[model samples]
Target: MSLLAHGNSILEVEVTNISTHGVWLFAHGEELFMSYDDFPWFREVAVKSIVNVEEQSPDHFYWPDLDVDLTREIIKHPERFPLKSKSR
Candidate 1:
């Protein structure tokens, strides 16, 4: 037997993993990695702060626990954005 999405779509973002290098997130059917090199805020934060995640919009993500927010594109291609800790 197989399960379906039913009436509502699951459009939520979540922090899947946290490693010495960085963090992993599962969202929009994709697993995105955020390296501490690029996103330094998560390097020293508590595990609870890292795990809390929310998808405010289709392409936007928000982490209320740590007051951190990011976009799906940025998470995928961080090199494009040169300035670190940029204002989002």
Candidate 2:
């Protein structure tokens, strides 16, 4: 007999860890880190909000609770997009 596949295998992005300094994301078998210095939006958000991530598309992630959207490129090279939103 063949093994069954996952119900939602395409859902590949997730928040694996959160610390005082940053959050860790796991996507497509690779782990990416986002520091508070680069991703300040997540620094002060609640854990629930932070983990509530959705993969809007390939390489794109969204946090509905925080109303934040990010792509793999942005996370990998934050310097390329320097104008961040001012703190609320």
Candidate 3:
């Protein structure tokens, strides 16, 4: 029998590393890379602001400090969706 849910344990989404090129996020047993080329809002941001990320849902993430909300799909395949808002 297959249980409809995972074991009762909390999963945390966090920024594991940050570099001039991008940031590494650890979530749900996977490590994801988000580059400044696609995620320009993160460029030049403080470490405190960059690390302040929240997982609103299993596939949705929000950075309250940056006022940004992104989905796993968007983060993984940024090239599929072009036309970013002009960075100031």
Question: lDDT at 70 for candidate 3?
Answer: 87
TM-score of the candidate numbered 2?
0.86
Which tens-of-lDDT digit does each residue in 30-69 have in candidate 2?
A: 9999999998899877898988888887898988988999
Residues 6-60 of candidate 1 have per-residue lDDT tens digits of 7655647777889999999887679999999999878888898887777777869
- TM-score, candidate 3, is 0.83
Give, for candidate 3, the lowest lDDT window spanning 10 residues.
Answer: 1-10
- lDDT for model 3: 0.82
lDDT (10s digit) by residue, model 3, range 1-88? 0112366545478889999899988887888999988988888888999888888878788889889888889999999989675553
Best of the candidates, TM-score: 2
Number of the predicted model whose lDDT against the real structure is largest: 2
Off by over 4 Å in 1: 1-11, 86-88
Q: What is the lDDT of residue 40 in candidate 3?
A: 88
- lDDT of candidate 1 at residue 18, scale 0 to 100: 94
